[model samples]
Target: MSSRLINEYLREDKLPHIWCPGCSHGITMRAIVKAIDNLNIEKNNICIVSGIGCSSRAPGYMDFNTLHTTHGRALAFATGIKMANPKLKVIVITGDGDCAAIGGNHLIHAARRNIDITTIVFNNNIYGMTGGQYSPTTPQGERGTTAPFGNIDKNFNLCNLVKAAGATYTGRSTAYHVNMITKLVEEGIKNKGFSFIETLSICPTYYGRKNKKGNVVDMMNYLKNNSINVKAAEKLSDEQLKDKIIVGELYKTQEPEYTEEYKKIIESFQKER
Candidate 1:
């Protein structure tokens, strides 16, 4: 279905979006909405939360129960939101800086707890909203305003990071892989425990300009050419997989979710009392 027709599900007055042309934030937002529609979740039952940075503008454009919180604090706020109600389907939208930099602690603990929430990291590889600063996921040897000499720091492999932190569902996809992205988001929403989706989004105005990546199409093509499936990755030597993009669902498992465990403890305490 056309995105315009899907507009019936959105709050259109909020439109004339704030993102630059070819930016993938809108695509990510649409993918989430499409996932929600596919899941048949009640519109009122889902809460979309966001942190500061360009990607944080997502919740503002979305029509669901939304919260635009302080910088790098969306996970903390989302945790509280999930705990208090335990019924709300909370989804946190954050940028790479917001998730892996200042919010690093919150991100890890939330995953460690297997919290019943979905975290979407819009990793455009730079601090797009704040003058194109280098971020934790920025490619090594890449140029940024802060890394004019080329970034010397290693980037975080978000999929492995979240997997190690114990997220029940972990996956990676790029804005270029729209079908896979939409599928993963849908699966994440339906999953009971913590779900982490790292979308390699495009920031044409900032990241593109700094890296000579040109336009959104160029970035998308880069992702397309570089991507490999997890199954295919197993056969390639470590050297061959270096700097290659791995797309598709990386890991998933069934585990007791945080809310369920929390509730069981509360019930047991009440019985003892």
Candidate 2:
């Protein structure tokens, strides 16, 4: 299945991905492809967009209409692509820093508009591509090259942020739970409005070494032990949930999608004319 997916969806020439050994970005990326395949969406009907970051490299390797845009601007570019052709399934592959830090505004506005786009955030906690800088999602008190003394800012709960901002569908999953990532992404793609799926990727090279998160195995173990499915969490006490990663579909609802609404206005004007 992996080989078939590689040949069908991935650019074989880019066989060697640049992510460090044990990095979870690869797992997250493959899950995305699996979701697309599960949907059986035509290769020509998909448009994958990305910004500058380790995770953004996915679009280049994916066999689709891909756009490699500037840092933090993938969503802006994706918005245009989605507006121009609502028939196309637009997917934005972005990292924590690329999506939540520099591209924060775009994230919120896109969600607010309820655009028909599936945004998958490969949140590895720290900036992996542009050095080991602390990202917006970096847990408070975690160490990074930019926060050698320990990060002081409160990390953003990205799932909560997007849900609050009006994303019709939202989910959170980790690289350890590869199947869940694929499931959430598949559901996100099926949604008619903005959809956000945050995949907690592991940056073992920088984030791990700097924060003393142990080796890749240890990091994977952490995800396995610390994550609680949202359904299971409902039965756990607040104390039991402390410091636990909530994983699963967080929110879902129906709303008027942006491009469709715009089309309705254009039709109304044409009728009046």
Top-TM-score structure, candidate number:
2
Lowest lDDT 10-mer window, candidate 1? 1-10
Q: How close to the true structure is residue 204 of candidate 1, measured as C-alpha lDDT?
A: 87
Residue 155 Cα positional deviation in candidate 1, in Å, after optimal superposition: 0.4
**Cα lDDT for residue 136, model 1?**
96
How many Å off is the CA of 215 in candidate 2? 0.6
- Could you give candidate 2's per-residue lDDT for residues 69-155 as a string of tens digits? 999999999999999899999999999999999999999999999999999999999889888999998999999998999999999
The top-ranked prediction according to lDDT is 2
lDDT of each: 0.91, 0.95
lDDT of 1 by residue, 165-226 (tens): 99999999988888888899999998999999999998889889998987778888998899
Q: What global local distance difference test value does model 1 have?
A: 0.91
